[model samples]
Target: MTTETSVDVTRIPRITHDEATAITAVENRKFGEQLRSLGPDDWIASTDCERWDVRAMAAHVVGGAAGQISPREFVRQVRTGRPIVREIGAKHWWDGMNEVQVRERSDVSTDELIAEWDTNSEKARIARNKLPKPIGRLPLLNLPEPVGRQPLTYLFDMGFTRDVWAHRMDIAAATGHPMDLDATHDGRIIADIVAEWAGYFDEPFTLELTGPAGGTFTSGSGGETVRIDALEFMMILAERTEGTGLLQHTLPL
Candidate 1:
């Protein structure tokens, strides 16, 4: 495995607002359907995420969507030291924001949460596409990897897209329901995630994800190989799996 702390900022590709918006729409639609299918009891069931139940996890996902258009909250979140600023401080920031989001939405019905997600996700999509001059080009500091500052496009495209996907899986696992993952749609997002993961480590490793989202990738010298189901691989990145080597190095998204 390659040991490198610096990420090649130039190597990072740019994503158009149109692409990000499209992906966001897909994630929101499926996520909305899943929320609607939940019974009252299922909403309160516990998820793999500690201290977070089905309802709380949903709130967190909705909060992430809502946060995209909420500049004020973003500022406050940064003040509280979000992970993109310092990965080490991420746990506290994540817990604090999640608690606030869940508590504030406690009185909201599941239907309302779903509606709000749709609304905010659209707003975020518009905002991302129409970001004014300098703002769109501004460097993003909130990232799990300490590679370097990235542009706003990267955050909205890679970060938020994967965030929604990961949480969708969380809810599914918690409620014992299967995800509606489509190879083409979900595959695009997961593929981008794999590309990003490749840039993080210089050590040669091979990853083969087996499922509709399955694919093969090589990083560094491609010496060590990891074979896993697509969903389980994502779970591992979410820190829900235990193993050695790359499995221990959690991806930021």
Candidate 2:
């Protein structure tokens, strides 16, 4: 995580490398456990990602284990600001990890899914730990300017936490299973995402979140803005959805 030495972070607490590592481990295990849950026939069913299914999501989880970051030589080429991955086509880049999954695990037994999870979890933990501390978040610099500098690292940290829960819903929705969240992952993500809505929206809008569990919502400081319990809201931020909704509920300053 990046540190702004000058900023007083009383409101936005930063998560450490170790914390990131642990969360990655948690996500990996959760994905495996969920995948292991399926009957053989369920692999081809639809998933939240639109074009993919349970199997494809499994492929993505495993592919995440592959060299997720660009190599040193490539990163060097991207020095000064341009992202190395940005130079490549989305399909081509995704293919790199796809290659890893197919090459390394083509023969992986269903029973070994959790073991693969453990392997990738450790690999991701070590790799993230070895990297330099973040200069800024936004793991990928996709947006155009100002907001591009948004706290993506926090988004990523929050994403993983949210992913485990959301994807559990994804899995559950696909397979008709029950949903339950561990307190650790649930609270952190809910907090960060709530704050993220406050930070992202231009208006001093207040949110009214309504989900299956209950109904109570978060409002920004000075009654800025509000976020409803729209799964679409979470999916859009997760990049699982293409566009945004109700971004500005009120007039801005």
How many clashes does each candidate structure show, in the order listed? 7, 10
Q: In model 1, where do residues sit more than 4 Å from their true spots? A: 1-16, 73-94, 146-148, 220-222
Q: For each candidate, what is the lDDT?
A: 0.71, 0.49
Off by over 4 Å in 2: 1-16, 68-109, 134-140, 143-166, 210-217, 220-233, 239-253
Model 1, 52-83: lDDT tens per residue? 89898898878766666778876565455444
Cα error of candidate 1 at position 15, Å: 4.7
* Location of the lowest summed lDDT over 10 successive residues in candidate 1: 1-10
Candidate 1, residue 179: the lDDT equals 87
Q: How much is the lDDT of residue 153 in candidate 2?
A: 52
- Model 2 alpha-carbon miss at residue 68, Å: 4.4
- Model 2, residue 7: distance off in Å is 21
